[model samples]
Target: MGRAGHRTALMVAACAALLLAGCTGAQGTNGPELTNTSPVPVSPGSEADPTSSPSSGESDEDGDDEAGDDAPEPSASATETESGPAFPADTKPDTAEPTGEGETFLSVTDVRVAAHDGYDRVVFDLDGTGSGKPGWRVEYVDQATDDGSGDAVRVDGDAILRVSLSGTAIPTDSGVEEFSGDRIEPADTESIDEIVYRYWFEGYTTAFIGVDDAERPFRVFLLEDPMRVVVDVRH
Candidate 1:
């Protein structure tokens, strides 16, 4: 009994030693050691390579640029102005020949005077069986006189401008109603004082314009619808 028991104990002891050696080897050398921390995972398309080239349309030193920053601004002179047609005017005596056919039989039918923004206007309307507009001559005079009789004509003003018209006839010969006033005085006048109208005699007619100022600047022009002779006197 004693020998068998001893032999059994020896076998059990050897078995226990083998089991201990197997566990020590597994912990120290065979497999890697485990921990509570897990390995970090990589994100898709998130990281860039350090050696790669930069993308297009990006500034290296400066930030994003604004469009048209260096362009010049619009100038004030570029803007346009609204104005009427130019009317050339002067103070010198003016004369013009008859237009269209040389022969004419125009008679003064009406007279109009008005005050404007910078001037006073005197218009003489004429109508008859004429083929052309009447010619005229305007000049400053010391004293007004009748063209037919050479008689002194009384006019009231500081200065007088004589307006003589050609290519004209009397009302009876032209078959047109003529203006029937010896003098014309208008209200709200800026430069004019009065006008002395002499009836047509022969082929010419004469008139005197009394002005407020001596030798004021004036302009003469012709207009057509019904044919008119216009005088503009600056204040």
Candidate 2:
């Protein structure tokens, strides 16, 4: 206690045993022993705020680039509305030219005429028996008789020109039989305008002449055969 106070108490006991051996090796390499009655608290960036984040990988790459740019704008708006309208993929329709004058009493096959938008049709292809001799009769005489072209034949306006008889004198009491002769009035004489009488009891007998205004022009006649006639005129 007197060698310089025992050498300053042996250098303060060797610096308090080297500071308690460096606080017991820093609490055994930084694990347990933080005692204020340890409760659970080591919040230093709380585990890097949930798994090594860079804002969660930039929010998952902006949700996969907004789902790949909204998936090609509905397939490019369905490929620009998938085109449209352009008809003519093998088109076909046009045939009707023959207007009056005798000598064509039947013998026609497959003739078609179609004009649209305001109605225009003519189709004929007929040849042969439609009944027994004198089984079909059509007469609208108000005057015109030399087989036609004398003026006085009207239909649709009811001047009385209507006849559709088929087979064996067609009169099973009365299905069709009409003839006008009030002098056959309504005469602008374009040959009455419209008439269609298709008969089939044996083979054929078709007569269709419709024209009310499609630039009027129509005529057909194929008669001569114990009186087998087919006259259609509209002009």
Q: Model 1 — which ten-residue stretch has the worst lDDT?
A: 76-85
Instruction: List clash counts for every candidate, in order.
Output: 0, 7
The 0-to-1 C-alpha lDDT of every candidate, in the order given, reads 0.77, 0.35
Model 1, residue 7: distance off in Å is: 99
lDDT of 2 by residue, 169-233 (tens): 22222233322112212233343444433333332232333334332332222233322233332
Question: Against the true structure, candidate 1 has what lDDT?
Answer: 0.77
TM-score of each: 0.61, 0.20
Q: State the lDDT of candidate 1 residue by residue for 1-235, as single tens digits.
A: 6999999999999999999987887798675675768856654433454344335664434543433466687643211111122334545677988764445678998887888777787888889886788989988889898876789998878989899887888877678988998899887997899999988877878889999967787877777766888877778
In candidate 1, clashing pairs total: 0
lDDT of 2: 0.35
